[model samples]
Target: MSQIVAAIDLRVVQLEKQGVTGMALANQMMGHMADLQMIYNTASDRDLRKLCQRFPGFGRYAMLMEEVSEQNQTMAMSGTHPYGDLPDLPEPLKTALVHVLRAAADLERDFQATADDGRGDNQGRLTTARWRWADDLEKLIYQFQSAELPLQTQALVQQIIKATAERIGRMG
Candidate 1:
């Protein structure tokens, strides 16, 4: 198990060093992400210490991922960010992603930029971002539904959507 994890760590590092980007990096990480999510889901609290021991950066890495996921949910509920996490996602979902991002950017430039008071303070910001979030959900659902995802992956994606939407709805 140690050797296997060491190999995975080495491979990911090597890939990072190779400067993979955009759709390519997304495609590669999809497998690892799926597997990691599966293991993470199944891990008992008692198993956590062993997992951290097995993966040198597991704790910090997982925390950061959770933080990012939370931030994404916050953005969906609150407002459009000036910058996107990634301007693009990998196909076969890129088409939908690009369209939604463009729409959000257009809103930011046209309405958010011109607001006398800061747009962030206004409900318009939340409205615009939610528009994009709606697009985000639609596209992602299509992507997930169409993909040959494992059961664990499908469940995880569903959980993410359901949780984020539920939280955002509660804020309204």
Candidate 2:
């Protein structure tokens, strides 16, 4: 007997190999990322500055997500993106991409929350700085939601995943 394959079947294949779905992977990835965040948040100003300077494009997607002008000279921009188009990625990658995006937003929110609770400088400067970054994160999240990529066709989802991979690869 012969078998039939569909677009969704690849997702199952990926699950069998990875042993974790998109959301779970997203959570795990974010957990690791959170550790980095803690380090960044705790290090001395000089060390933290160095870290930021070294890994400046840690969240380069935040710029594309926020739709910042690629040519803007003021904003510290990474080089041009190669993931300008989407490809036919497996379902697991697509779902994981969305969840990972959510994770990024969550981290941003976590930072914002700390500021809101007066955990930083009592003089409000630290809180203000946190808010400044938080607002940018929020805008990225909002942009994803507005794009409605999840509900769109598989092609669009693939495009996002491809773009994501490209940006991520460029990070290191």
Candidate 3:
């Protein structure tokens, strides 16, 4: 997974070389990514449910749900943001993002398992683990989003963001 994150980071480097600085592409990616982090930080199932109301397409955000369902606990919480494009990120960054997603997925699993264990003992550790993973992901996302790529690349990123926002904005 770390390798994947490294690969994605490299891709960002490559994109920078190709010219993708100052564009909203990085920012847009960060926004959706931040939403994922927020969801993982959610403290209650009810909150998760409320969050889901905005993007009914949550089932598509499978990075973390698989493990949760396996534990037989339903999400009572909701989160903002839907799954959008994650294309073009380098392997390391991409892998890191995926790992973040996986961690979220694993968190759901832990949440459910704790419920079943009924010991209430795992809650503290699970919560700590989830937060730890989320924090790291947040740092990486911030690093990528704030990165200053080449000037031409920046313009291209802005163009892509404008086009994408326009497209998705219509649906919203």
Candidate 4:
């Protein structure tokens, strides 16, 4: 399983270096979805959490790839109506979401930049941003867990939180 994951990770890096993007990159990644899922499902919780800490950006990369693939499928199926409207989020939740999103964007931006190009220490910046993102996500999860949300929303949040907490735990 580790070898399979390593091969996929190497392939992704190679594709990125070759300038693959959008549907092409997502399509390539989609081929490894089953293997990735198997690894996630079969790995022990402690091992998975360690893996996440060791490769901080990998979870986000896999999620983005899967999302891109799903969006492409949706667009192909719906042609013009590719997405639906988002629900009206509660105020506190909305604010939390915004903060989390901004932190995630900052993390991604830092991840893309050179770690040390003589101007600044972007590796430290990236680490800070990653922790901020993780903290914000945990706060958001706590808010959802404590709020008087709709049953479906609460259930979905609980499901996601449970899976994530069990598999990868908290980064901070």
Top lDDT model: 4
- Candidate 1 residue pairs in backbone clash: none
Query: What does candidate 2's lDDT look like per residue over 1-172, in tens digits?
Result: 0011111122223323456444443332332333344454566767645544544333222222224333333343453433333344456444445455444333333443444565654436434544554464445445555553534444554454344334333321
Give the per-residue lDDT digits (tens) of candidate 3, residues 1-172. 2232332333333334445443332432332344455555653666545544433333223223444343333322232212122235566655665555545434543554455557787767876785686576656556557765454544554554344334333322
The superposed Cα distance between candidate 4 and the true structure at residue 73, in angstroms, equals 16
RMSD in Å for all candidates: 17.7, 18.9, 18.5, 15.2
RMSD of 1: 17.7
Question: lDDT value for candidate 2?
Answer: 0.39
TM-scores of the models, in the order given: 0.35, 0.23, 0.35, 0.40
Q: Pairing residues by index, what is the TM-score of model 4?
A: 0.40
Better of 3 and 4 by lDDT: 4
Residue-by-residue lDDT tens digits, candidate 4, 7-126: 555555655776865566554354355556677789887887666566543554566666866776787677653233325669878666555543443343334444223446566755
Candidate 1: count of backbone clashes, pairs at least 3 residues apart or interchain: 0
Give the lDDT ranking, best first: 4, 1, 3, 2
Number of clashing pairs, model 3? Answer: 32
Q: State the TM-score for model 1.
A: 0.35
Candidate no. 3 TM-score: 0.35
Cα lDDT of model 1 by residue, 40-130, tens digit: 7777766756766666544434444566667768886676743333333356554554444334333322332334344446466667776
Off by over 4 Å in 3: 1-87, 147-172
Top candidate, metric TM-score: 4
Whichever of 1 and 2 has more TM-score, that candidate is 1
